[model samples]
Target chain A: GIQVEQSPPDLILQEGANSTLRCNFSDSVNNLQWFHQNPWGQLINLFYIPSGTKQNGRLSATTVATERYSLLYISSSQTTDSGVYFCAVAVYYGQNFVFGPGTRLSVLP
Target chain B: IAGITQAPTSQILAAGRRMTLRCTQDMRHNAMYWYRQDLGLGLRLIHYSNTAGTTGKGEVPDGYSVSRANTDDFPLTLASAVPSQTSVYFCASSGTASSGYTFGSGTRLTVV
Candidate 1:
């Protein structure tokens, strides 16, 4: 089983601010994804970056597989981005995925 | 299109009672998963099915059981509910083992 650790357990930002969150895994992984759990508790898929980098809207993520770490960037944050962001990973030969503790973000309008 | 729907958004059950959380997906995905979210600990896998008729235990499956009789349905059952089992449950489905998964809205259960 792999262990995923997320940094900055809690974060608060003003509207239009930017922030970055990091995730570190204990072992190699074949699949990695970033999810945003909205206030209503719906887990929205933000990125599926096993490696390299990807961007969508004001969010972007980078996974350095070799370093066993990943980063998620939120630029020009909005009130809508206020929620818990999670990073999950699935090992190459693992049957289940592991998730980090998550970073709770609050955006003040 | 009803990508995924979970039955009984919330439930309050007495300890030692039996309960089942139903999850169904219309996408006909081959892989289905069950996860539980607890305060501070993050989401932990309960069980998963690679396809119909095949099941596997996950990180925390001692008090939970799941079955995938068909491609579209995967239900998790708690044989004897306990207060420790109280948490938010989420069901997810994916087309393949290496693809993004679509998760249900989640089920909040309380065993008192």
Candidate 2:
């Protein structure tokens, strides 16, 4: 089983601020995705960067397979961005993905 | 128009009772999965089906059963509910085991 850990378990940022959330995995993974669980509890997929960089609007993600790590960047954070961000990974093309505890972000207006 | 849909956004049941959570996907994906998220914890996979007529156990499959009789539906059944089974359950589908998934809104189940 692959272990996934997210850093900065809890984060508080002011609106318009920028922050980076980190995810580290214990083994090589061929599939990785970042998800945002919004205030209403909808888990929205933000990125599917297995080993590269991807940008979607105000959020972006980068995964370095060799390093077994991934980063999620939020720029110009807004109140709407206040929620939990999770990173899930599948070990070397495995069928199941293991999710990290998540980084709880709170953007103050 | 193409996504996963889970029925009974939330549910409450008594211990020893049987319950089934419905999940349907219109994307016609080859892989479907069921995950349970406990309070203050991350989501843990309970069961997954690589394709129709085949199913596999996940990290936490005890007390849960899933059947994939067709391509569009994967229903999870609890033969006998327990309080420990109370959690938010999410259903997801992917084109394959190697791709990203689209998740349903989820079902919040509470067993008394």
Candidate 3:
């Protein structure tokens, strides 16, 4: 089994602040995804980057497979962005994904 | 298409009762997974089905059983519920292991 760890277990930022959350995996993976768990407990997909970079609105993600790490960037954050961000990975030749502990964010008004 | 639908958004059950969580996907994906989310611990896999008729245990499958009768359905059953079994359960489906998955809203369960 592979291990996934998230840095800055907790984060607090202002409404217009920018932040970066990091995820590190213990092994090489063929699949990696970032999700935001809202207050309602719905896991919202943010990005699916196995080994590249992608951006969606005020959010973006980059996965460096060789380095076994992924980063999520949030710019001009809003209060709605306050939630738990998780990074999950599926190791090569594995059928299941392991999730990181998550980074809890709080964006104040 | 409904990516995935989980019935009984929330449930409360007696410790010894049996309960089943229903999950269905309209995408015709070949792989489906069941996970339980707890505060601070993240989401832990309970079971997974790679295809129509095969199922496998995940990280936390002690009291959970799952069956894949068809492509669009994967139901998880608990033979006998326990208090520690309380958590938010999510059902997800993907075309394959390396692709992005679609997850249902989730079913929050509590046992007494």
The estimated TM-scores of all candidates read 0.96, 0.97, 0.97
| Model 2 TM-score, 2 decimals | 0.97
Give a tens-digit lDDT track for model 3, residues B1-112: 6689999899999999999999999998999999999876789999999899999999999999999999999999999999999999999998866668789999999999
Distance from true location, Cα of B82 in model 1, Å:
1.3
DockQ agreement of candidate 1 with the native complex = 0.68
Q: Which stretches of candidate 3 lie over 4 Å from their true place?
A: none
Per-candidate DockQ values are 0.68, 0.74, 0.72
| i-RMSD of model 1 (Å, 1 decimal) | 1.7
What C-alpha lDDT do the candidate models reach, one value each? 0.92, 0.93, 0.92
lDDT of 1 by residue, B1-112 (tens): 9588998899999999999999999998989999999997789889999989999988899988888889999999999999999999999988876677789999999999
For A1-109, candidate 1 gives per-residue lDDT tens digits of: 6888998999999999999999999998889989999989999989989999999989999999989999999999999999999998988733466889999999999
lDDT agreement of model 3 with the native:
0.92
Best by DockQ: 2
